[model samples]
Target: MWALDSGICNSLEQPIKRCTAKVIAFDLETDKTVKTVDLSDILKPHSRPQYLVTDYSPNGFPYVYISDAEGAIIVLDIHHNKMYRVVLPRAISAGCGESDVLYLLLVRRPKNQNMVIFSYLCGNKVYGIKSEFLRTGRGSSAIVELGSKTKHSVLLGTDGSNGVILRYRSESELYKWNTDQPYKECNFELVQLAEECRLSTHVAPGGKDALMYSLSSNVADYLNHTCGAGGASARLKYISKECEDDCY
Candidate 1:
């Protein structure tokens, strides 16, 4: 397993100090760290790094896409021990704050692992680019805007296949969209998983069987009524094959 350590701070209330951070590789069987990569020199001074493991290469090397405070993605090639920085277009990343850039999602295409899709939750469009282009820092024309529309809902996650999961603020059902489909066609609900509690969706790790899961909770009610007096009920559930078929 691999993990990123952003260093320590004085207290929980205080922000993390602008210190050097490390990416550690561990041997699960022996429970020992095998290697460590220092980010002090590669990362900009005082920049904060957020770890995001979304896809892997055809050769099976996991791509570690780290989002920094400056609205740029630091793509780490673990197998080759190489690193590259990816900056979004000015129209998409300009004037974006740390929190705004954190919402950008990167997912690899199931049909073609060499390609990657990038989307922002608040933005009306999605972009696609070949992974090779990012590695070589080549042609800007290689990055293409795949889709665009006046979006009203927020993106939840990917289906781990070709679909992008989304949901309205007031709805309980999840919707999906693919590159080939029109915006209005995305109204089809992938699942009606909850009615009362709020739901958070996640793509299964490693994209196994293209499965997706959700964690539903009534924490809003608990906070409003109990005021941190007790624990709120929650359930972890995966969307099964039967559920997926029924949606179609």
Candidate 2:
């Protein structure tokens, strides 16, 4: 029951009410209620709510985690309203594991049209994505979308920021940056309106909606590459034109 805003506490958006108070916690930065906890009607005692509940769901709803908040990691299930807590350091601007593997946060820099990729190591130390000093600046936002269970990348949307997102694959030559080439003419008029961007992939057999970063609403004008598990198998299939059995 962390109420930083004296205003929104009394509102109906919060998790619980007087007769059955069910709110697990509340974040101060993004003023909004986190309901649909993994647990129903269960309660836990905390020394202070303000000490936990960091930034959450600035854009997409129901995707939230309090790092090291629940003595581990706190997973609030939006669909069922249950709370599952896991112990992990919930840093504000980080979402990568030990290796530089997962896709870090990506933002665009307006100054020089560069990108910034925010990464984390050992799950605690925070790192920034840079490419030859052409990336990163202040007041930039970072968004990390998991490309797949084993692969992920940061989509740097903040213009002029040094958080460039680069894609990496196991057992293959790592790819360079994923910046939108200016000279390549876009085909759609709507894509021309987007201020920032994030590229996500999905599987058609899995209904295409269950893929990584599937919660995103933007799916136009970007290269939609199919991801495969186990690099060698994916490559062998690609060489044989048998990609459909895996990709689709």
Candidate 3:
């Protein structure tokens, strides 16, 4: 199922009627339920000039790609609001783009050095991508960085390519897996890893052939509840497995 982050919770009422902040949540395909959570209530945002970064966890949770004034990735306990900045070796230029698959790319190229490790919080798990794997000035503009998916096995994808890699974009790089192929340029705007790695397209379960109950709504209509990825963190509320097909 595909989802976006604009919803009623992020809406304002009058002349000052609009939230500048983006609200996040999830949309389940089985039942057209737009599950949204108010982030403002979840995290305290400072009212100062703060550089921002954002990415979605594997299951579509907004795994906030947070950073600080000094270009350092901030690791935090989302539920408790505690934060610790994991500084990269040097300032790295980065951007967030996803492929046909579900892996998020955190491509960082440090200006001062040829290596930079990526660090950030996603699915409530702290992760790191070292610079050795991402040799900055390498022959190929592409580099294979590794990490795991919501499913445990390690996943690797090419970051940055032979394109106009914005030299100034140093916040975070998001990617998706479409297939096992190393990379395939996406016709879609998002940076896709390949067709093999893309997450399965979801459709509402209906009719007699339907083993599950799918909530109906435009994929764009509802906010999806982010199920923290790979079961790495605390369990979010699980409603049931009573559908035609078990979902456990």
Candidate 4:
């Protein structure tokens, strides 16, 4: 089953006050429609329904979290046949995929300030953590640089149960696996190893899949030996140098 995004249907021809878009779910197996949710009253007219992200509830319910470009997250309770909205402090940029934990990654900045901040949404509330280690530069540039450096990052599997797992290319020219139990309030750490890798929390479950990098040089040697490239294979290309425009 998949969700369909019906873009702005002309309200001028229709007998309605506002333009309404519908999200419909189809049962591919039975070839029948399951449910239809109208988004006109809940979301603004200009909010494009093109890119929608879905997250299954970890609480073992049929509550599917649906988010769109306009920062609106609608929780559709399939069992209860009701829909509710999650109050977001700001537009969420990241969230868990396939995992049972309903964690959302949020990046916040103060108005007219030269600072970039990171926070997480768990248990229906936004919580800010100590991320001084992530502040590489001042102002928006810092966030931009961090985002650029970690652009090739991945969401590795969680820490066993109820934990967040992330893997990304670091600014230190090393591939690292960042793991933490954000829901449990545990200390997060970045490990210089890659045993498992996953996807970004901000992207859809089947969206852009991230490439997993192995930290061990032996893996590179093995690939080189098998392929007979001898030097600088695609595996080694995973390691990258810091950008020259780096503020720090």
| lDDT (0 to 1) per candidate | 0.59, 0.28, 0.28, 0.36
Error of 3 at 82 (Å): 5.1
- Number of clashing residue pairs in every model? 0, 48, 47, 2
RMSD of candidates 1 onward, in order: 4.9, 18.9, 16.3, 15.7
Q: Which stretches of candidate 1 lie over 4 Å from their true place?
A: 8-13, 26-32, 46-48, 59-62, 94-98, 104-113, 139-141, 152-154, 168-172, 180-188, 205-210, 217-228, 231-234, 240-248
Question: Residue-wise lDDT of candidate 1 within 1-248, one digit each (tens)?
Answer: 77778875752357666656878878999999998877776778656575454456655666666656454567777778887677666675544454553433455465544455555545566566676666656634577877664644555666655566666544556666664454454444565454455555343323554557655566566646752644677666665434532231
Q: Write the per-residue lDDT of candidate 4 for residues 85-159, one digit (tens) a residue.
A: 443344233542222132333222233121111222222222322122122112222222122121333333332
Most accurate candidate by lDDT: 1
lDDT of 3 by residue, 1-248 (tens): 32333322532233232454333334565565554334344233431112232333334333333333233434323343443434333212232121111122344344422222232222212133333322211211332332322322112222232111110011212233332222223411233222211131121223364232212122221223343343222111111222222232
Show where candidate 2 strays beyond 4 Å: 1-44, 47-61, 68-70, 89-124, 127-248
Query: Which ranking of candidates, highest lDDT first?
Result: 1, 4, 3, 2
Error of 4 at 136 (Å): 37
Evaluation by lDDT, superior candidate among 1 and 3: 1
Worst 10 residues of 4 by lDDT: 130-139
Error of 3 at 85 (Å): 4.2
Q: What is the lDDT of residue 192 in candidate 1?
A: 46
Angstrom error of the Cα, residue 196, model 1: value is 2.2
Deviation (Å) of 48 in candidate 4: 3.7
